[model samples]
Target: MESDMTAALIRPVAIKLDEVTKARVKRLAEARHRTSHWLMREAITQYVDREEKREAFRQDTLRAWDEYRSTGLHVRADEADAWLAELEQGKDIEPPPCHK
Candidate 1:
């Protein structure tokens, strides 16, 4: 099934690993009963997943800050903390509405 995918769908990369690192990769791959290529793919997948989440968080924070500056409406840290505490206590409380 994987081979059925078009070449355009998968880009190949060339990596030059040091001799030690290459041996380590082989050993680790063998321990997991997987090929070094599979391990490399997994590593890249995880890196992309983590970095994408961080990028999204940064964009969201910037957007929220912009909105707050434009509207002058915000929630106090104490209010937010109290709401969070209620959540920790398993209370079904709604979040406080934001206001100027």
Candidate 2:
């Protein structure tokens, strides 16, 4: 599933597309100096990678929400903003303490 693993072992896979979409893929492949197979593989790989990241973020958000509901401990928006601003200015510091 790594995008740069072209030289590794591979297998043949088939997909069916409408004629118009097939033509578009062909044209784009030619324009990009790549084969249609390569284009499709790249697209699928990127889609999977992006979806995995999104799912991980969703899970993390749910976990955080649950923890907040349990403890009611959180940082204020202004405090977070000031901490981030300090980091943006090249200052390394810990995040503001979370409290009720």
Candidate 3:
């Protein structure tokens, strides 16, 4: 199921890299015992993962701002105190849910 999910999200695109970059990538792949294509895919995946994380963070910040705006008038001092306390206590904070 996880494999299918990953496969569904990936699409192939052909690109032309500079000759020097292509040679560097080839050498890197050889050192890592992987094909050039595999190395390229790994690089692309890392780039995409970084971009997705940034986008998710931006969305979460926007959502938090929106929530704050809507509830500012009704927010309780105790609630704010409790949230700060939780943060100071070093409790684990869950990451935002992943979106397709």
Candidate 4:
């Protein structure tokens, strides 16, 4: 278990923060009873996670658009609207299938 925890340890990289941001991080770390280093790590982890998700979504959207342009396959708007409205009304609804 200790070895597993050691494997999970992150290597440090140097970063420079402006005075205000450093002060804010210190304050929050004190409030949470944690070190500034731990707070910075958490902040970096969360930011990377969010940005990675956004990048993935962007890539998926680009692939979808290319597929649409190539095959001209898509779901119609009215059918999608009806399906969503049913879901909004507390009904179990499968999505309208994509079609060419």
Candidate 5:
């Protein structure tokens, strides 16, 4: 299975915002009928989603390079054609195994 080390190192952070920023955020939250905490969580969730996409892109680039170096060919999207074909044939193909 893929190992996710990020979750182990995550911790809740508390920050004190300046009065102006707090007031703006409070106003925004009030308009939306949501608490400050809900607004903060929503902002954090969006940030995390963007960061995850960036990280995934980086990882895929590296993986493509490594695959090319080791196999002397670029990794193609259809590299798993055999496995996909098996599924299309109504075979009960198991999920591809993962590594730690």
Candidate 6:
């Protein structure tokens, strides 16, 4: 099972890069004491992770907007700020309740 997982994870993917960009990647990889493949893999992984989080945030924002439009219930900015200020001063109070 582990061997199958390893085999699935270690597939080869080819990407094209300009000569200058390729040289830069090679230099950076060498400076970081990592292989070019490893550096590119790390770059792709980080990019995907960041983009996934960004997409999630975008979705959450949209859902929040929809909910606010439908219910017209939300905390005032001043109330939220006061709550945050209390928390920053080490208070462990609950958040302000949402209102219409």
Please, what is the TM-score per model?
0.85, 0.87, 0.60, 0.82, 0.53, 0.91
- Per-prediction count of colliding residue pairs? 0, 0, 0, 0, 0, 0
| Candidate 1 error regions (>4 Å) | 1-3, 6-8
Q: Write the per-residue lDDT of candidate 1 for residues 1-100, one digit (tens) a residue.
A: 6666775598788999999999999999999999999998898899999999999999999999999999999888999999999999999999998979
Per-residue lDDT tens digits for candidate 2, residues 1-100, read 5765864667787889999999999999999999999999999999999999999999999999999999999999999999999999999999999999
Check candidate 3 and list the clashing pairs: none
Once fitted onto the true fold, the runs of candidate 6 whose alpha carbons sit more than 4 angstroms away are: 1-4
Which lDDT tens digits does candidate 3 get at residues 14-97? 999999999999999999999999999889889999999999999999997887677664446676667677778997654333
Clashes of 1: 0
13: Cα error in model 5, Å: 4.6
In candidate 5, list every pair of residues with a backbone clash: none
Winner by TM-score:
6
Measured by lDDT, the strongest candidate is: 6
Deviation of model 5 at 62, angstroms: 1.0
- Computed on alpha carbons, the lDDT of every model, listed in order, comes to 0.94, 0.95, 0.83, 0.94, 0.81, 0.97
- Taking every candidate in turn, the Cα RMSD to the unseen true structure, in Å, is 2.1, 3.7, 8.1, 2.2, 9.4, 1.4
Give the total clashing residue pairs for model 2.
0
Tens digits of per-residue lDDT, candidate 4, 1-100, equal 9988987895669999999999999999999999999998899889999999999999999999999999998999999999999999999979998897
Clashing pairs in 4: none
